[model samples]
Target: MALSEQGRHALRHPPRWHWLLLLLILPIVAVSLLFEGWTTHEVDGARTRRACTSPIPRSADNGAPVLRVTGAGAETVQMPLRTAALTFDGGPDPVWTPRILDLLRARHAHATFFLYGTQAARHPDLVRRIHDEGHEIGSYTYTGGDLGSASAVRSQLELSLTQTALAGAASVNTRLLRLPHTTTADTMCGGEWSAARRASDDGYLLVAATARSRKPPLGVVRQYSHSALGYQEATKLLDDPEVGRFTTVTSGLGRPSLTAPASLLQRLQGNALIWTQSLGHRFARSMTWALGIAGGLGILRLVLLACLARVHVRRQRRHRSGAPWLREVNDPVTVLVPAHNEEAGVEATLRSLLASTHRDLQIIVIDDGSTDRTAEIARGVGDPRVTVVQQPNSGKPGALGTGLSYARCDIIVMIDADTVFEPDALHRLIQPLADPTIGAVSGNTKVGNRSRLLGRWQHLEYVLGFNLDRRMFEVLECMPTVPGAIGAFRRDALTAIGGISDDTLAEDTDLTMALWRVGRRVVYEERAVAWTEVPSTFSQLWRQRYRWCYGTLQSMWKHRHAVFEVGPAGRFGRRGLTYLALFQIVLPLFAPVVDVFALYGVCFGDTGQAVGVWLAFLAVQLVTAAYALRLDHERLRDLWALPLQLFVYRQLLYLVVIQSVVTALLGTRLKWHRMHRSGTANQHLLREPAPQPSGLASK
Candidate 1:
């Protein structure tokens, strides 16, 4: 059925909201990365912190911790009374800050707290408590980073963001600034003094701790953290008989409070910032869990494939070891070639089949309304065994059905018009069918046009991702796909399912599952090699994969009831279908999130860990791919581009799976999309004698 104009337009240019949603994903991910970075102290952290580099100037009275700077000069400020100003540095910590506040409450002390923006943002209630208890607020330079070591922009952001965090948490902004990793006014040397001067220009009164020796008798300004040691020090000082009343810096200096109530607009902006940070935190946390699960599942699948492949190989060796397991099948067979505008490769396909080592053959070419000379090219092969059937513009299943009507032989082999089979491929593909219980045999499908990087990637995927999994599937007796490029079926079993039906875009998958439903064993034949052309460009690959994925989903849903049925159907349903659902459908959905989090880890989090995991994952894949390649008798050099494939090729496949899932869920009908054949499937054959038909078998 033809889609409506709206549907066509919608498919071509999806609704604005769809694009808007896509656009939102990046910004949302970026914000989430930023939030996680800030929470983890990556934005302004101890890793980038430094200590005071030079001594205090002589013009500034050195012993005093607080510096009072005017437009003309700078001087130290001290309490007129025999008073000590108690200031806490670093946290508004969740546990320590609360405990310290309790001690201050008990003593009726109003001190100063220089807050880390991260801690304040994380524990806003503590920030509010400090302000409400009459304790003065001061900036602790965001993540307690040293201002002298940081760039000018870093210094400003640290100060402003801290002010905003305070405004959001307590509705107040402070003018008192304390550079982290710097202590005692005398220690403010070189770059530290310059940074202090810069803060003074912004109306910030720079505060440091007084020298420990002089401060004990002179009632010095003390610096502490919201920590156990800081609490113990504070308690002892509170009980000191020599020290006068414990109070805030401003109060002891006989000056007004440095903190002022934030403007309404400032408060709103600050609150928004706070809310965004919290939301990002939640998003990051969720993605982290999702990424871990996805990563684990991915690794688990590779391990399963590797282990099961070994079992599959051993089983094969055992089978052939005794007496050629299922005796060599020399039965007459009918080969069905479905084509639509496949002129470029129809001749090569027909020639390859005609030259089959299994001599007795009947080849039927069903040309479904080709604008090009596909039937002509096929007929040009000039073999009595070849028969070309032309039909109106119908899909692949239709073409297959038309060809099936002409299949006089009991064994039916279907090969796409774009595939070139090795001489022994057909003979080997059918040997498994000799076992009466086996209904279908999946041949090894290799990418032939692998001279280019894109082709190499596809070749790797064919050997590693698809073929390796098939080995495992065969071992588990749950094989899901028999490639359209080369698959064999018993005529009785093929006919039992009412021949081919256009039930799904992936007729091969649908047909294979149908065979399994009727208690037919589908097995893989790695020795049965056929070379087919995979899409060479990203767009071409996308269309081909999109159709395949969508059709697979439809077939899975169609055969969903098989899960409850007993025997072969139940095994395939439970194992093959479940695996497809979990690994293919569900896991790929989380890929974008996983990919973003991976980038976050590399850029803003632990880069070594991130890169190490990625390299490890790639290394495992490479090892498995090498094993698979050796099993298929291919060279190992193809793995040189495997790393690049992970970064580029994998993302494209992820997107394809995502879009296909979305299209399936939307109930969109995916019309059969035929790829343009470039006759590249016979690339290996070209390396053979020009007169003889051969594929990779010649090599």
Candidate 2:
């Protein structure tokens, strides 16, 4: 079976030209149709009309002046009409429809009301009244079918037309159409050219909603402070007479010119890649675009994030540099430790609590009827400062609640039995509670033994994620959670919020919000660090994080009423709630898709050189990790793991998020699953187990 060296060489080293040939021919082959001279004029499935070489000039009558403007890569014009048309959609309801008709009639206007088929069928008298009043009655749609798909758009359009024709003989020749919800382009209007051609072919002219379109529920349109600048620009454009020419609302009236470039961009163009690509085209383009845009956006984003990280580091440094917070709290504190099946670590945790530099701390251990000798070990700690309470297992929240009820101090600190606190952790944790305005303080949690790759990753997460970001949230007075692992609270603050509820999975987040509602200040103390066991196996990590995410969502749902409150925090509460939704929920859901598109750009888009895109994206991830590492003092080599982590590992988060969301929607329960720990920080510590001395052995 031995082959000659020459034969082996021939098999191993093939010609490089084969690779070069593919690289040269792909782009030209892919975009050949776009280069074809054929100009698509109309769409068949959806009613659409492309801006095809400007419509033929129509005669102006009834003392109407022709208005026109062209500048800055755009053109606008207005035509006159003998009659004004107003369209009202989405009701025959008592709340809105009748009032809308009175308003239109007051303006001496004739409107074309597009009724929902179901609502119209139910309100036959209302439909007749619209026709009876000389207003042109129409249909919104039969079932709110999207006007993006050819068949769906055609069917919906015809159904609406049929319903309108039934209302009156004059309505049979109606050509005006509107899309439901307006955010239909990416999903239904895949190819603009094709959709336009289809709609025009069906003798329909698409009408776009203007800024004056129906406001969202509760007049919240005015409350959209996040995009206020953009809205203000849009609002100003709505008032301009020439801007009305490009707008459907003033198509027949002479109006002011449109100003905002962004408004124009959104109205005129659709994302060709997102909407019109075949699966093959998508696969080829996804990498190129994903790597390019994500690379660019991710770079600027990381730069800003790095600055924030710096701010966090500086704050932590200042806190550590100045007098420690714990020096102020001289009163004896009640430290509550909730233990369940924790015989392995409960003793060590108790020992650490007894060793606290603050001599005024008393430890309260609640042993929730563990199957093991957890209660006996806790009692055997023999510290006069410790009080052991035994109760049947009712979960961690229930156990914590029971201990809290019996706590004798104004300041109460909750620490997990598995967590070994730093000598100063308890002192530093309670320092913030001394401030009359402060309600709670959260301690930083670090990984006890980060030897495995998974553990190291978790370590990185704690340093950069849990520790750093939380400081920023605290500065904004919107700290999302005071972690159960090592958190201290003012007893009055807890009592004001009616104590922690065990209904939701994440009692910590729920409690945090309750504190905020009462206007209690929560602070993060970096010096108050505890080393605790983290999930070592991938599956354990998945389950732990899934519960965390699900619990977060559950708590959010349970406390949604606090979002717009004029409570103690007021504006801070509103902003904090907005940040929670934007970053935690929305960004996690969208970031994966954004990454996919960046990859598409790297593989197929016009990102100059392919290697350039690759390098840019690599630089962003590296820069982000570098700053993140610097802020937390993690190893620099951790940055190198980002690409691999993103490719092979980060996607697991998306799956967990999806699963958690689905489970929540379906009303599923998930109890916290603890991971196994080696019970030692180093391999040498594991050489011999801790000696079972006689004083700690008896129940």
Candidate 3:
């Protein structure tokens, strides 16, 4: 019962919306990065400003006069002698802001507070306190980003978001603006001066400090940040006899107050800002948790693969070592090869079966309306034991059901039309059925064509992913899919489960689960190896995997109620289904989100940490894959493709899962995807002679 390669291209070619949705993610991420201040330039030449550096001086010697914009343009306002306006920048800090505010309150003096939109939105209570205490509030821009070097959109957002945050907090918008990094009025040069002019054009009063003097100066705005030095300087100024009065920026100039009632639009904008801020915070926190869970699950899977794989290897060795003494049953086994347009490999498949060491064999090749030489090829095999059955274009499941009806023996072995078994594969495969309790057994299926990179990748997946997982699944007592490539089933068990079911695309997985629900145990036989031709190209691979993934999903859902059942059914349901859901469905879905976050970190956040974490995960995977290859008796050199697979090949698998889920959610029916056969299954066999049978005589 080989996987049909027909209509594979259609299944693999995703809908336009799937690609458009993927393309749309880039722009959304770009916009998010921009808003997060990734695109903003720093204040001090190309370097980001860490904190407020030097305090603004307070004297006429500061060179250029600070411009106070009015309806008539701009005017330089000079303070009256000994009248200094104390100003604080970069706060509403949770700790320092409160200390500065308390200091000003105790001194009975007023100062203007320049607020960053981010800090303000985070602590609106502090913003209200600043306004209620009679301290003037001025915009320092959102995130305190340098507007001069920022993109136009970022610059506008920086200014407008500050206003929105201020409005949301205090129900007021400030007309006074303080350009970050500008100290004394004379410091406004180049980009700073340009930014100031732009601010003035927007009806903002550009405030800067006067030069420092030996004595407290009059009619100057003394700018400071909410820091220890700023607090100390403000305290010293308050005690200076030369500073006759301390007041807000506007009050010092005898102009209107900075605070005003926010308009309807401003209030609405403020509310929206608050909502977005909250949502952003929640999203960030959730992503952090998601990354943590993903890392944890990934590490856990690796550990299981490495540890349980060792156990599986030990168990296999012990079983094989005892096989010589075990009671041998030369049961007349019926091998069913279900075919559909597999003419290229049909001869090799029949020839392999004829060469099997198992005697008293009955081989039936069901050609399900293959519009090729599949039936002719089977009949030409010349083996008297081989029987060719022709039927209409029924699916693999139907063909398998039809073959089972014609089967003459109790022990039935089903092999894909393109699969070539090792000489002893059938013999070892049927050994497990000798145990009356074991109703079915899955054989080791390896990719036969490994000449190309894609083929090599699939080969690694067989050893590292599928084989390692089967080892763990066997130990866990939740063996899910006895692959159709080479699986042996008892006739009674197949009949009990109603033969092969066509209700799901994954007939193999569906039939396996049904057997479990009926209290039949399915096991794995690693010694029984079968070589099956895998899809060579990405398109063919996508189609095969997409159908496989979609079918598995359908099968899981069909048997979902088994989770609530008792005994082995519940055990398989809970353990197998849970593993599938978390690792298969949920993990793949979150993988793209993880990649997006990694990109965000590289572009806007912390690149070092992101790269470090990614490398660590890759290292763990490499180690686990190495162990899996060793367990499967594969070469370590093949592991070079493991890391590369993580980047490209793994993403394809993830997309397959995603598309399968999307299709299932939409209740869309998918046809069986068939791979074009190249008859590569016997290529390896042709190079090696068939091994002679041992212990038992060949009939």
Candidate 4:
């Protein structure tokens, strides 16, 4: 195509990809949360935190526990006088570290506390408390891992991360080090000795406990876990007669402070890490709870629909047999078809109406300024009962008003030009109106071109979402809409509402709400079936749903005052409108939480739990879909597409809803999108068997 044609095509299909970008927010946050979870979470085994009793080489000082080894030579020192340097190893634990600090505070003694970085980040207060009391801090390799067993990279990360954690907690970096899973200089042997030499090369004073058999008067460096047993042993050592004084390693050795001030840049980075860890934890925790609520709400909706459908079937059957209000309906009904460039399926729609089992009909086709053969096609259909009325392009509501003026019968039926009714659909549809109280009846709308995957997904939605939902709505007497594909309305009710209107894009929904507000009843007739041509392409489906969603929002807002009215209108407002807001509007807006958290669980949480919950939700949906199919007399084979729909088609629908909501909030007008029909309305009509007569059996 030329550049001009490309430009025209671009204008025709304006970029809508940007609108769906909101859906990416959840996944991005989930990924960041998973990353934080991975980096911050550490699980050290029991053996890694245990004290090693291995023997050391004969080069270093036999009694001293502080070593500064360089090259092939090693040097060691002990505190002069009969004094011992008190040191606590493994952690500045939230529980035991605070208790140990209290014990030291009571005795007026100072000790070095080796902090596990993971614990330090979580309990920074404890690290600060250890430093603020004129004490010392040292690295226990973040998670208390045995450096002898760690790789070179692991060893470096363990030490550096501990430094960062200390920097964030107390704004200082420590050179004093205590290797976990070991006690004295004698135990720092083999690989432990190698790791010790590497640490000494980096200027870390390898601190260890005095030999087990040695006395504290010989200047001991204590080793202890931030645990109950360690607290007990440290208390005993503090009161020991062999120990003259309890002082920090630097103080006992008469050297400068072991901890140096951290740079501003390192402090900022450490603080950022702490902030992100906290954020990720809170976000994941909230998402989990919210996903559970969503799951529960979804299950509640399905359960209610299933139970209410049963009640509806029983009530309808009971009315048919014994209720005096219900009588056989043989009244003449007028059918209105609003056409706007629907040339593809106009003839099929007309012929289907003519072939209806209820033969006494007046069919009027209103041409809404179509720049196509829509008007000519209706006129060409040679039927005495068919009438074609031409009008200017004033939109769908204007065309419906024109057709309603031409309708001569007391009962009126409205349908789309791309819909074909079943032979007995019109008869069964009007039968519900025999009660005189029911002002409108909704018919089952099925997808005609259901051979493709997209069509199959829509077919499932019609059965479960629209048809099953209508059953519950009818039982509750809060039916929100009688779809335009097939619906019957009392002439008086239509006139009272000023006939079909352009007040909202969903004229059908607007009209139905008007009926409810006027003390008139609306109901669903599942036996009344109509096959309508649905959009075959994704672009067409998006545009079509965008209009429907936006229009429904408008109708809801327009009739929002009904909640304050009396009788039927209040019932619908409280029940129907509230239901739509919670389930349709609000729930859909938060539906992405399910997918986002499910991904997070799989990435950083329990895979089985996530998969189990997802599968459980899917199983519930499948069971509900099966029941809906049974009610509609549809085969179960179509359910194969239901699972796939959750991944792709369902996501598209929610995105359209979100975009439509944003557009509605902005008060932007949405004109009707003229769908490209394939004229396949009659294909399903011929291929599928006539719907079997439904009974009041427990479907």
lDDT of each: 0.82, 0.57, 0.79, 0.82
Instruction: Give the alpha carbon lDDT tens digit for every residue of 555-661 in model 2.
Output: 77766767778754564467667666755665555555555454444443444665575676677667666665554444577555566666656677765665666
Which runs in model 3 stand beyond 4 Å of their true positions?
A: 1-26, 37-46, 49-60, 63-86, 94-110, 120-135, 146-173, 182-203, 209-246, 258-281, 323-326, 681-699
Quick one: ranking by TM-score, best first?
1, 4, 3, 2
| Per-residue lDDT of candidate 4, residues 523-590 (tens digit) | 99888888899989999999889878877888888889898988999999999999999998988887
The TM-score values for the models, in the order shown, are 0.92, 0.56, 0.85, 0.88
What's every prediction's RMSD, in angstroms? 3.6, 20.7, 5.6, 5.2
List the lowest-lDDT window of 10 residues for candidate 3: 690-699
**Per-residue lDDT over 305-328 for candidate 3, one digit per residue giving the tens place of the 0 to 100 score:** 788777776776666678721557
The better candidate by TM-score, 3 or 4, is 4
Task: Report the number of the highest-TM-score candidate.
Answer: 1
Off by over 4 Å in 4: 1-24, 40-100, 123-126, 141-162, 177-203, 206-241, 323-325, 688-693
lDDT of 1 at 561: 77
If the candidates were sorted by their lDDT against the true structure, best first, what order would they fall in? Answer: 1, 4, 3, 2
Residue 7 lDDT in candidate 3? 20
Q: Tell me model 3's lDDT, rounded to 2 decimals.
A: 0.79
